[model samples]
Target: MKVKDGIIGLLIGDALGVPVEFERREYLKEHPVSDMMGYGTYNMPPGTWSDDTSMTIATMASIINKKSIDYNDIISEFCEWYENDAYCQYGLFDIGNTTQLALINYINGNPALECGPDDERSNGNGSLMRILPLAYIKDIDYETVENVSALTHGHKRSKISCVLYIEIAKSMIENDNLDIDGHIKIACDKIINYYKDDKELIHFKRIFENDLDDIDKISSKGYVISTFESVIYCLKNTDSYKDAVLSAVNLGRDTDTVAAICGGLAGIYYGFDSIPIDWIDTIPKIDKVLSLCEKYEAFCDEY
Candidate 1:
């Protein structure tokens, strides 16, 4: 149920923003994304999802098939998505530069864990966008989450972002009494305590210490920090699944990834019923994603 709640939410958010991924915030302010429209950015149909959903599905499928976190298998599935378009509905698009480089590193024989570039500049939302499924796995740990982020975004900042995001999602799944800010505070406390000595902690000071209420201060760019900040801002500001993802998309640049990440958390907290039925009906081949979610939930239960 958590798998379906999160993944389908991610896909809806991805599909909603596919047609306006890179439009500027100023532009979106004038021309907001109100509904699922088509063909503006990618020239695809109304419900076509971008690489965000595809890579997420690839991650879920890999886990379901292997029944364990096989790093090689996971990267192989990513390769399949990049080269063969196995998980995509309308061929691959919006592949991040960092992700492309890491997959190439894997193709050129680098180990899965080492393929990602570890430099500070390599930090992007590439890894965080697809990390939701891992939070559903019981007993999943920080190192494993870090390893998965290292598959495409090896920077310490990126890894910490993924871990923090998962901890928030896990909190949402396990506790219904907490509000969004409460769940985020719980995750931040854990991260701050564990990574107290790490330099990367400075990068998250705004999220860890501040309320992130200033809409003007938020950046919805592709940078990992920016994306995560944008997600937190949108989640804190909005009260429903629709408003959360819509706010993310309207923030403009990097619309799909931010919305996808926000939607994953919003879906879990708001519950699947909170998502609009018409939005779910719009995505093509949604049943496939739903079916995968069922299998993935089963696998996590057994694992």
Candidate 2:
């Protein structure tokens, strides 16, 4: 699999939703996001990505530099982005509350693995948004995926969401012959078989059962479960990468995170060439991101 196909796919989706993030579903129904927009929520120009892409890039950079998945170094890279705006397109303008608090915990002497809050309320999409890169790593284990999610969202529910997402992405990367539903079903079956007895599995019944077609049941909120559901709903319902992400953006709240998550899968399924060139051109620092993807792909190959 080409690293840029999924990574840049995620970047384009983030840019598409940055302008309309937090908008309610009702508002977006009348004025849907059809293209990349600028200067709306964050007042930044079009094609500007948010913390989702920054944290993702930071993770890849740390892995390449350390030649391994060093949790401490990865957290330090996140701190660099949080405090110094490293890896941002222009500046640090957006971040989830859970992520911000976790970084502060790390800053105040907490260990990288212990920095995230374990409270039930801390289950935002912060970890899920950046966990896509892990899907590309060869022989990555579930425990490592959990630890990475625990860096900002330690709740078991949040960790499970990240793992399930990675499972789906890995399916796409490894099994290109399957249709979208086929890929999702394979991942869902695995998650069900692995985490069947966990209490959090109850929360994932809709996904495990492939029950995401109803729009009323899907949500576009910041909650990790809702975000995961939205990603699946958007992907299952749309035909192309552009349609999938645009469907996600129009769902409104937490638009960037949902689109980013969905776009990662769509990018892998459709290939990088399927993404619109105009949208790719609007993003600043994209060349640097592409360079990082090359380096990260090489590291994964050698790992």
Candidate 3:
């Protein structure tokens, strides 16, 4: 029941903020988004979702159809699903250059491992944004999360960030006996153990542990590092769904993705009850998402 609620909460928060994403904080102050029924924006209407939910639904669809993570197959599914206008109401499908290049390369027959660029710069939050479904599916197993992340984003940074994020959600969902500090410690210890020798991972861990005071100083850009930081910030500071998402959305850059990622973690921590009922009720495609949840529940029965 918690898993079902968590997934729904994620989509609800993602869809709720679609219209206000990237709008200046001043504008939101003057015209607050107090509900999800609708918000008229320059280009889209209220209740529209962005790539966050689109890719999430694609991930869920792949799991339902294939019954397991297939790297190449999921990539193909994402491309076909996006191109076919499956989630067209989300506005322009302007995907990131790295993801677009990797997809194009895969279509031209490049090996999945070789599709992504060798440069570390390609490690963006794009990988993490589409990965919440995996958290609920694997029940937060570190090895399983790492394997799923490597399927599309094989870079070391991408893989580590993905693993850590899902582990956070997993710890929250599975550890009824533990408190928040215990969960954070367990997840951080696992991450440190996994990449103890890797400099980037070490730097990231150090930043997470010792740099609470400088969170605003840390970049909130679209990179994986920034997204990870933002998630930690939202988790540590906010007490409710509204505070968590509103704080993330106001963090200046990459607002939607940050809110989506933060909202997923916060949803797991606070449970579905923390989310506003009115927002959840009005989210677009609520019935379809509920159907997908039912399918996932059936699949879990077999496992």
Query: Alpha carbon lDDT of residue 232, candidate 1?
Result: 92
Task: Point out where model 1 deviates above 4 Å.
Answer: none
Question: What tens digits encode model 1's per-residue C-alpha lDDT throughout 1-303?
Answer: 468888988999899888998999999999999898889888889888888899899999998898899999999999999999889887887799999999999999999999999998998899999999999999899999999999999999999999999999999999999999899999999999999899989999899986588889988999999999999998988889999999999999899999999999999999999999988888888999999999999898888
TM-score of 2: 0.99
- CA shift of 107, model 1, Å: 0.6
Instruction: Rank by lDDT, highest first.
Output: 2, 1, 3
Tens-digit lDDT track for model 2 on 24-108? 9999999999988998998999899999999999999999999999999999999999999999979899988999999999999
TM-score against truth, every candidate? 0.99, 0.99, 0.88
Which of 1 and 3 is the better model by TM-score? 1
Count the clashes in each prediction.
0, 0, 1
RMSD of candidate 3 to the truth, in angstroms, is: 2.7
For model 3, state the Cα shift of residue 228 in Å: 1.2
lDDT of 3 at 3: 56
How does each model score on lDDT? Answer: 0.92, 0.92, 0.70
Clashing residue pairs in candidate 2 are: none
Estimate the Cα RMSD of every predicted model relative to the unseen true structure.
Answer: 0.8, 0.8, 2.7
